[model samples]
Target: MASRDEVECWLTDMDGVLVHENHALPGAAALLQQWQDQGKPFLVLTNNSIFTPRDLSARLRSSGLDVPEEFIWTSALATADFLKSQVPGGSAFVIGEAGITTALHEAGFIMTETDPDYVVVGETRNYSFEAITKAIRLIVNGARFIVTNPDATGPSADGPLPATGAIAALITKATGKEPYVVGKPNPMMFRSAMNRIGAHSENTAMIGDRMDTDIVAGIEAGLHTILVLTGISDQAEIERYPFRPDEILQGVHELVENDPFLAEIND
Candidate 1:
């Protein structure tokens, strides 16, 4: 376990730990500001691949959070980074929004549908049947299937919406190929974020709400994990999971009160 004074970096889930229901969670903004004031490196991680980092940063700022674009990491970015490492300048048939498209482009991947190297799927509000059909055809043509995340559903103002994992399942059923998911619970996403910030797992801390995705990934990545109750998992649900977080808090407010970054502040 990493001590409070030993933590030199922070990796946190964006939706649940920092903001929920389009509002910043209690003490989220203050804790983030404190991290910045103390020059602690941090990144806000998310499995949602609908929006680009800039778009997510704007959303957070509007909701009273102050995370910058560079501090935000998405599953799309992780997928792109992984693809780039495997096959540089590859072509992909993508079925996602600006987030996936932008990340792939920046990573030197060419977006194509004419016998591409990969069929990449991410979250999108416009999950068109035509696009899915194309992705199926591409996978059938020997293109590798990749998905941003394995989350079956995502939260919304209305209700839960079918996410990338659900859509990836449909594609898998049609093509008889399982997608390589690169998101939370995979640990690849966490390791990629750690590499991005040049932080070691022993000195980094992770905060999240979901025990399945966030906490499990953190544990696997060898980081101290804190599970907050502001999002998906509640106290009762946590008991069902065999894994556990290093600490549990009601919200970021409690974390602020505890002052995990006190050593940095004092320094």
Candidate 2:
């Protein structure tokens, strides 16, 4: 692991590392407070674009981790930022949860349930034919395809379930179009986060539970990576995979406790 003094930013995973199942994971709050005490920067970053930053902040606060709205970032927001600069008027044919729509709308995009200039897909607990058909129509009519993260599934309290990939696959099958993803493993998404932290990739370390998206994305962006065993990835999975993380931790709490001689913090 890199020395603490060398660290500039700690990019984090929200669901697995900072929280689990709507509850704050043990050590998460303290670790965050530790960062705050040091006046160091961090973020609650996640591929699950199911809540707006304000909504997510409230959720986290209710769950016992009181963080500010600006401290939380999601794939939905990044996707919105990406589309704002690329797609004029930011009109979209979206197949995602309410958060995605909210971010798109907040970004001055005209969100539509039907005919659109782009088809942006994200996680939705309920997948339906009508939903797929709408996206299919957009793609067939030459609408640009964008996806919030390509995770094939999501983490359940038990594990993972059929995810955004499955939905994208259904849409792709219907229209023979593949969507451009704007989450982890996508450098643009990482760049967006770096922009938020005002840090360079060389000084940032992404801590997450998933290897394919989080770790891979960090590596691709030239950022250091830390994989924890608390979420989707396990020791067995790490051993089985060709990709490797720069460091590994059992969970978020262990991360803070393992650091040598906690530095005197300012904030």
Candidate 3:
């Protein structure tokens, strides 16, 4: 793997690396500004498919991170991109919020209930039983199943709530069919993000907090991977994974502190 200095493009997980619970982490804003000033190609990546890129960008802004909509990549967008490539202007029976719906619409996909080409599932707070029933029936009848991510649960103030993977599992139990997931842990997400920034894996770096999803996917995509302890995984957790990230740090603050480019700029 190439050293951090050799990297020309960067992809970082949003929740852990930059923000947590709607608040920007230490040095997150400065790091983004540094990248912008240096003309570095970078993107903020998320497995969450509940909100559109515009919505995510605004949320980041609220957290004091100035990431633009175009610089944010979600699993929703990657799913739409994958499906668009598979079947241009295809139709799907979708169970999701504006994120997945908007992406599919922009990709020329027709959203319908009857005899759709695929049954696409994404993240939503309101998972209707009726909608799930329709999805199950459609999948049982023959529509291909697709899920935005494999995350079984999402963090909430109360506790962990059912996510796309959990719903997908329910549908699978009823229909006996597994969904083709298109999010983190699947290198396709990174590849699509890299393609968006016109970055090659050899010259790209990925920053994430989780070993199972972010780090593993980065390694599979052939990009330099950095793991931060700000969210989810820590030193002990890192040892659990057979593979390891290229670098591990306390948080984004350390990343900004150690950056040679930022040092040169300060000098």
Best by TM-score: 3
- Number of backbone clashes in candidate 1: 0
Write the residue-wise lDDT of candidate 1 on 116-146 in tens digits: 9999999998999999999999899899999
Cα error, residue 12 of model 2, in Å, equals: 0.1
**1 or 3, greater by TM-score:** 3
Looking at model 3, the pairs that clash are none
Please identify model 3 stretches exceeding 4 Å from their true place.
257-267
Query: What lDDT does the true structure give each of the candidates?
Result: 0.91, 0.82, 0.94
What would the TM-scores of all predictions be? 0.94, 0.88, 0.95
What's every prediction's RMSD, in angstroms? 3.7, 4.1, 2.9
What TM-score quantifies how close candidate 3 is to the native fold? 0.95
lDDT of 2 by residue, 69-165 (tens): 9988899999998888887586887888887998898889997755677888888887788878777887898888899988887767797798888
Model 3, 82-177: lDDT tens per residue?
999999989999999999999999999999998999999999999999999999999999999999999999999999999999999999999999
Q: Between prediction 1 and prediction 2, which has the larger TM-score?
A: 1
Error in Å for residue 98 of model 2:
2.0
179 in model 2: Cα distance from truth in Å? 0.8
Q: Ten residues in a row with the worst lDDT in model 3?
A: 257-266
